[model samples]
Target: MGRTFHRYKPQKIFEKELQTSEFYDCKEKKWVAVIPKMKYRFVIALKSDYPREVFDAPKYYMMKVVWKNGKEQVFEADTKDALGDAILRFRTNECFWNNLGRYAYRVYLDWVNKSGRLLQ
Candidate 1:
């Protein structure tokens, strides 16, 4: 054989520059996604305390998504594989374009690490 061609690896896209924090959710009884940079600090609301409009905002609320199989679930940052799979499936399957596509896109950006494995 004169020559052989092999697939070339692309340059790494993620810089690993983002800072992340692990917070425990006492109500959910599980670890939540790493908190990204915020312009303002988040307020914690106690069950016994008064209700605040800011606390009910979408940004402060935990993101919940429904799967294609009709099961609803909360998206977590710790589970990269599941998020990656969902991203891939969402991109490839047109039927899911309307349902969980929006949530999957958000999770894709959240869970994708420096390795960029989910992009592949």
Candidate 2:
């Protein structure tokens, strides 16, 4: 019998709407995706130690929300879909309001009203 060879294709992680451009961070030496918002931005990076091809989806993602005033929070998810859901929750005010306070939430609302998709 002859040996068989098969080509491998990486699976897509996030849906179309949840997808974002990724860039390599020289300081961190990892691939990361940055999602910008009205008052803060989410930085999601691969937690794996081994290097991966740019198109490959990692198993673990680490999310960091960096606020305008330099405050930041960290979160983790096993899949990219879950990470996207977390970001959506923060954007739609489903959670995390208390930490940001009422004032920040109002500001975010105003921005969403005035600029619409500019928040994304």
Structural similarity to truth (TM-score) of each candidate:
0.26, 0.33
Candidate 1, which ten residues in sequence have the lowest lDDT sum?
39-48
RMSD of 2: 14.3
- Per-residue lDDT of candidate 1, residues 49-116 (tens digit): 22233333222122244332346444322244644454455565444443344434654464344335
Model 2 agreement with the true structure over 1-120: per-residue lDDT tens digits:
975544333232211112234434555656566565335454445565434543453456655556645777765667644654544466544234433423333433353355344543
- The pairs that clash in candidate 2 are none
lDDT score for candidate 1 against the true structure: 0.37
